[model samples]
Target chain A: MSLDYLTALIAAVLFAAAPLILAALGETISERAGVINLSLDGTVLFAAMVAFAAARATDNPWLGLAAGGLAGAGIAAVLGVFGLLLGASELAVGFVLTLFCRELAYFMGHGQARQPGPDLGALNLPFLSDLPLFGPAIFRQSPVVLLSLVAVGLVWFFLMRTRAGLVVRAVGEAPAAAVARGLAVTRTQFLCCLAGGALGGLAGGLYSLSVKPGWGHPQGCEGAGWIALAIVIFGGWKPVRVALGALFFAAIQVAGIALQDVLPGLSGTLFQIAPFPVMILTLLVVNLRRSAAFREAARRVPLLGRLVPRTAGGAPGAIVGALDKGF
Target chain B: MTGRTSSLARAGFSLALALCVTLAIVAAAGAPPLTTLAVMLDGGLGSGQAVLRTLSALVPLLLCGAALCVTFAANLWNIGVEGQITLGAVCCVWFLRDLGLAGLVPPFLAVPGALAASMVGGAAWALLSGVLRTHGRVHEIFSGLGLNFVAMGVSLWLILGPWKRPGMASMSGTEPLPAALWLPALGGRPMSLWGLILAVAAFVLVAWVLNRTFFGLTLSAVRQNAMAAERLGLRPKRRMLAAMALGGALAGLAGGVLVAGLYHRLIPSISGNYGYTAIMAVLLASGSLRFLPLACLFFAVLTVGSIQLPLALSLDSSLAGVVQGVLVLTLFAARRLWPAGNTGSTGGTRNRGSAA
Candidate 1:
């Protein structure tokens, strides 16, 4: 690939990475707290429609964002009540939430399907946007990109340093212990589950307002939520690493789209299934070695040094808390 | 939950609970409480045909659902029942493509061919995940989920590309099968006798397989505690794979019956979320063999009722999907309200509805 292609690829990757980064980061926190919100995709779809409708109805981008957050939180709250308080299986509960939210969203967004909204405009930096290959491509991207990066940093810092983060992790590590130690397991689970759903929803909103920028059709939201969940697994539950996981996926998707222009034969009907194949492939690859082999493989990568945790010197523990205890 | 509560009372309580929750939601929507109940009941059960059609709808659902219970009992999550059914129908269409073949062979051959292909499709699709979980040490849920997307893509590709009916422009779908390939209506007897008998047989077989045989006992043990069972020299992976394969076959059979018995041709929407619909039934029937059919019929009624709610009230018909979701979630919650046996953790509940 030439420099121009590389530039285009990088730019596309950054843009594509935004939604996944936001979503995966959200999932990491939720899963870390021992709650797997399987409703991510539905949350995204519902929020996207609501956000688009609000933008169209009120003509304010901020209101649309708020509407998206509210709709997402509302669905999340329902999940929270059922899974946390009522003690339903989180995965099953989230799955049901997705169906419910998607249907409700379709109903709420019925007439708005053909309509458009006030799109989220791009944020063009000053002199930075004028530079050669990198200038216009990276510097002139949407604000969602920068916001997601900042969000990742914030999440990482909180998870690593904050007492609240420790509590959340503790809940996942041992809910019974947490409860025994005076922590309100129910309340923590409830809040964390809803918050996860809400964030996933907000990310869905960003997709609509910034990426697609209008009412979506059926299957409108697509599998971004699943991708986010995949990224969380791929990243092994770290904010910075998860962001990179998002970026890795973003790069592949951009390449897949761009390859359509370069080599038409490569972009056949089968390429539509690329994400599934790639996801399955990555999952297999990630699980290939025992913990020791994974550590050895990570040790050789220089730039990825920071991405691998010190614990990576030992066995890697991924897919943590995917299931609830005593289920 | 208590044995003190009569079986009749427990059943009544659940139905009433469902109705009360549903009516409360309707009331919140500003509809008159009694009027909504009447609407739901009329739409669901007022007419004889309506009730029969609902039962008919439950036919395929029960087929795939009973099949799901078999696999779920062994802790396998088979998410490709929809595609398997499509494959079965596609196989029948392919078999009867040359109209002369339909005239040449009896419907018996056609029926087995359709059902066999679906079982193969379901088994192969599930086997991929089962292998990954067993050998690759990957989790079944993610692999199964990934398979769902792959199946959809393959289905879309087949219908839209190679299998595209000639000269059809609007959308891609299989042409209708030749009539000889259709499952006969039981010596010209009506009332879906063939389908009804098959469904009943499926229910009985699943109950027997999960309860009667040594294999069934072993599989249940595997589901409850793989590690402990493994120490007893029972191969968990093998059992799990067998369970998934069995699940796929059952789901595929449902798909087969649907095509040969009802639709007579496979359209792209063959499964139409019915696999997930089975999930709802499975969730409602959690841990109970006898209650499975009851839950299935109740699910059918709720589904049919929701479809009619819009005509009965000014509510949108899509309320059916929401109600279905709520039913699963509510039943799951109710299950948790009083946790029962510590049978096992890996007792994978069929989201037959993913339906969960």
Candidate 2:
């Protein structure tokens, strides 16, 4: 394809990847703080439905976005209460909430399905829009894409450069130690989960108001949440890598669409279904480096041995520690 | 608060809380709460036909719940049960179509053969995730969720591509199987008695295996501490794999029943969220096999009754889902509030002794 076509494809990838990046980043935060929110898939769907309906009703996308974020925070609060305070299994609670929210969204948003709603249109930056290859691809996008970009940097900075970030990391790494150090583990985790939920909510709003631009039962965003969860793992619970994982997933989706013409039989169905398996495979590979058998097998092949890392580690200490706790 | 009395009290409180929450939602939706409840009850069990419909729905729920309980007992999250069910149905259909065995073999043989194929298909699908967990180090939840999507894609491809009906491919699904391949209906009802019978048998077998056998003790031991179980000569991985396979087989059998008994054909939505709903049923049972049938029946009533919401109150059928969700959440809340006599073990707690 021509450079212009390629740029447009890249732009499409960015637009699509924005939601995943946002949701995954949110999950990264929650999980980093030792709270797992499996309700993301349902939360996104519910937020999407709510945002779309609110926007259509009020004729204001901003209000709709706020509503979506609030809904997300609300759901996260429930998770926090049960998981952090009550000491329930966050995974189980989140899973049930996911199903519940999904069903509720369908039930409540039935009337709003296929209805017209405001969409955030493209906002091209003057100087940047005129730049060579990156102009149209990066600068001439909706505010949501820009927001997602800002979020990546902000999240990275917040986690790496701030005292609060240190505490969050410490809490996730070792809740008992954090507690001993006078940090309120439960309160910090609860707040982190809520913040993550808000981001996830915003992601849902972006999905409806920008990316897909409509509400439909079993909307196009169904499995996107699970992919976000996997992306968080794929990114190794880091912000920058998480963003990359989201972009990579989006690229796969765009490439799948692009390949529809060249590979007629396999492109549509197979391509659409490709991300899940590919994510699972990526997870397996990322994790396999830690396995002794894999290391032994790698040792037999000189090239593989050279390529393999000496150690596969970097899971948050608290997460690894909590694994023994059965969560 | 001790023993059975406290447990009963907790359950009662959770049910009441769930009811209040659901009623509040109904009110918010502009429907009269009492009227809606009455309508749902009538729709689910007012007549013989309604009860039959509820019972038919119960067959799959019970089977899936029983299946889930096995995996849960072993501390394995078989979230891919939905996908397994779909694959099972797909395999059953494939066996009937490609092998031409439906016509070649006797009715009795063909029916059992198709079901066996379904079980194999489901088990194999689940085993993929099991291997991933044991060897690949990937969590079962993520792998299972991913596999669920892949299974859906496969079913869609079969329906819209290879197995597309004559003329035009549609979402209506493939043509019905031959009469000889179909399971016989119960007492002139649309559903098959065989499905119900099979589900009950499976439940009884699982309950016995889980509660009364040495295998049950070992399985629990493995769940409680895989490392310790390994030290004690039990292969944790093998037990886990067996548990997953058995769960898959049960769920697959549910799917087989759906095809051979109810739908009479393999459709994309054949699984119909039964696998997911079973999770709620199993959770509601809270480690007690005796409550499994009751939980399944309760959910079946809500599901079958939800059909009336659209017809009577102009509400979506998904209202049932809202109720189910509220119920589970409240149940969890109640368990937390009254931990004294709660016998229902959250999956995380039974194995690792974590606070969760």
Docking quality category of candidate 1 according to DockQ thresholds = acceptable
In candidate 2, what are the lDDT values of residues B216-261, reduced to their tens digit?
Answer: 8888998788889999999989898999999999988888888888
DockQ in order: 0.38, 0.54
Give lDDT for model 2: 0.85
Please give the distance, in angstroms, between residue A177's alpha carbon in candidate 1 and its true position after superposition. Answer: 6.0
Superposed Cα deviation of residue B96, candidate 2 (Å): 2.0
Candidate 2, A235-320: lDDT as tens digits? 88999999999999999999888899888877276788899999899899877866677779988987778756554545666566
Model 1 lDDT tens row, B124-151: 7777878887777566667766776676
**Ten-residue stretch with the least lDDT total in model 1 chain A:** A313-322
DockQ score of the complex predicted as candidate 1? 0.38
Q: After superposition, how far is residue A142 of candidate 1 from its true place, in Å?
A: 2.9
Query: TM-scores of the models, in the given order?
Result: 0.85, 0.96
* Over 4 Å off, model 2: A295-301, A305-313, A321-327, B100-102, B344-356
